[model samples]
Target: MTAQVKYDDVEVGTEIPAQTYQIDRMNLVMYAGASGDFNPIHWRENFARKVGLPDVIAHGMYTMAQGGRFVTDWVGDPGAVLDYGVRFSAPVVVPDEGGAALEISGKVEQKLDDNRVVVALTARSSEQKVLTRAKAVVRLA
Candidate 1:
């Protein structure tokens, strides 16, 4: 855990520190089991190829969760998040060997009433394609 972010200390254009998340086949498998989303496109390479995917792709929700992690870690408490949403803009291609790395970043876009802030987030893979277009509303102390 980290220190709570005081509401008065943040500005609309302030950028939150970025973080990287590594995703591999094992991670996808584990997420599939945990989330009960056993879509073969997320695991079986042959199915992915048959479906015209470049390779076994990471689950969209998994990538979104990683982006959520970045924000939750920054805000110090998951309970501080009031609302969060994202659109899966691109598929995260998970290679068999090197896997894929996601770099996620956030910025305060607006300050609402009652010490709330709207955060805009961007998540990209190594190929520079945006994977998740996310935004969240957080309540600050």
Candidate 2:
């Protein structure tokens, strides 16, 4: 689908609506199955703790995908995204009880040529920054 947002209407510093995604053990298991990243640290608390982690943690790529979802949902087209990248900073610790909450937000950082804009994103979980240097380049309609 084509992007719903127009390049002419966008400005640097325009805010993308924030989104919060719930990540639980079941979700991690499903992600592991789908991604083939069953490294145990993502699904087994014992293994995670044995490896020096506080608890079972969400996959880094899963967290990055949430950031991607935030950008695409705002720009209104997944294909509009030309480039996306992030550095994993902290883990999203999932306890046995309630799921963890991953909060994602972004803003247009630069308006580039060719209807493209650079977006700076922030991802946080459990009051700790989870992803650093998260950014996406998107082409608007």
Candidate 3:
């Protein structure tokens, strides 16, 4: 685990290290089982095509969870998060053989009272953003 981030030491515009996460059919299946979100669009390509999607895509919540991971990983504690949200801008298309790659990075956008900071996030897949306006407020040590 990383050392805890201290509020006094962090400032607006500080950048968090980027992370790349891989998602595949098995990941979607596991998420479906755990989240009860077994939507076909997340796993079945033909069904996704029928529904007007380019291919099987990842769940919005799963993508959001990745955002959460980015925050928690930085803060070094899940309990540090006070607020987190995002806007799903596009789908993370999952191909059968190679899986999809979610490239995520964050920057400090705001510093608030009570030892908190807002971290702005960007998540991309397939050369396009999958989530936008994503931010997390974290209370640091």
Candidate 4:
């Protein structure tokens, strides 16, 4: 694990190292079992298309969790996250052949009083659509 990022060391526009995640049908099925979100759109291609989706998509929360992991991993502790939220801008379409890949990146957006910083995040799938627009308030040591 990386050492904690001190509040004094961060500044607006500081970029966190980006991470890439791959999601396949099996992973989505596992997530469904683990999260108890059996929404057909996440696993059944026909159901997804019937619901207006191009293909079976990964769960929004699963994508959000990956984004959260990016921040927590960078900060070295999950407790450093004071607050986090995301707007699901688009679905992550997982192809049956090669699956889907998501690239997530974060930037320090602002510095706040009392050892806090705001991190802005952007997640994009292979299709180039913004999958998640997320922001988090992190308490630095």
Candidate 5:
């Protein structure tokens, strides 16, 4: 699917709108079941603290997906993204009562040939940077 966002219409250093996602323990449980990565650090608070974490944490890949969603939603086509990656810098600590919030924002870092642009992403949870070196290469209409 071609992106509704046109490459010619975009500019380097353009800011994509930001988004915030509410992440709860149930979301982690569902992610674990879907990914088969039921590591206790994600769902078991006691085990997470035992492992030196503040509390139950969200999966790294799950957090990455949220960043991807932020980019794709902006361009208006998931298939428009040719490449995406992130380095996990911190954990999204999910508390028992209110859970956690993942805030994501992006900017167009570079405009490339072939209708592609490099999108730089930032992901934060609990006022902490959760993902670093996050970027996406997207082909636009």
Candidate 6:
């Protein structure tokens, strides 16, 4: 897919629109059913605590996907993202009462050759960063 944004019009520090995605237990259950990652740690708080986690946690991939969503929505083409990666720096603790919120934003980090640019991402939950060194290399129109 071709990006709607033009590479020539993009600046090195341009900010992508920020987005916040809410994750609840039901969401985790649905993702578990779809991804077949039925780890008890993601769905059972008591089991998670027994295993050393503070609470039921959202899947790391789920958090990372929010970052991807932020980038793709800004570029206007999911297929325009050539490369994406992140390091799971912290766990997103989903409490039984309110679940969790994943906040994502990106900036044009650098302009690459061939109409491609590097996007730096930040993903946070409850003021703590969940993803670090997140970036996407996107090919723009």
Top model number, lDDT? 3
**Candidate 6 TM-score over all chains jointly:** 0.95
Each model's C-alpha lDDT? 0.90, 0.93, 0.94, 0.90, 0.92, 0.91
Candidate 6 per-residue lDDT over residues 1-141, each given as its tens digit: 434999999999999878899999988888899889999999999999999999999988888887888888888888899999999999999899988989898899999999999999998899998999999999998
> How well does candidate 3 score on lDDT at residue 68?
98
Q: Over 4 Å off in model 4, which ranges?
A: 131-133
Instruction: Compute each candidate's TM-score over C-alphas.
Output: 0.96, 0.96, 0.97, 0.93, 0.96, 0.95
For candidate 5, lDDT tens digit of each residue in 1-141? Answer: 334898888899899888999999999999999999999999998999998998999999999999988888889998899999999999999998999999999999999999999999999987899999999999988
Clashing pairs in 6: none
Any runs in candidate 3 off by more than 4 Å, and if so which?
Answer: none
As a whole number from 0 to 100, the lDDT of residue 50 in candidate 1 is 100
lDDT of 6: 0.91
lDDT of 4 by residue, 2-65 (tens): 8988888888999998889888999999999999999999989999999899999999899999
Q: List the residue pairs that clash in candidate 4.
A: none
The TM-score leader among the candidates is 3
Q: What is the lDDT of candidate 3?
A: 0.94
- The digit string of per-residue lDDT tens for model 1 on 1-141 reads 999898999999999988889899999999999999999999999999999999999998898889778878998989999999998888999989999999998999999999999999989997665655589999998
Steric clash pairs (candidate 2): none
lDDT (0-100) at residue 107 of candidate 2? 90
- Writing each residue's lDDT as its tens digit, candidate 3 over 1-141 gives 788999998899999989999999999999999999988999889999999998899999998999999899989999999999999999899999999999999999999999999999999998999998999999999
Model 2 residue runs over 4 Å out of place are 1-3
RMSD, each candidate, Å? 1.1, 1.4, 0.8, 1.3, 1.6, 1.7
Candidate 5, run of 10 with poorest lDDT: 1-10
Q: How many residue pairs in model 2 have overlapping backbones?
A: 0
Flag the better candidate by lDDT, 3 or 5.
Answer: 3
TM-score of 4: 0.93
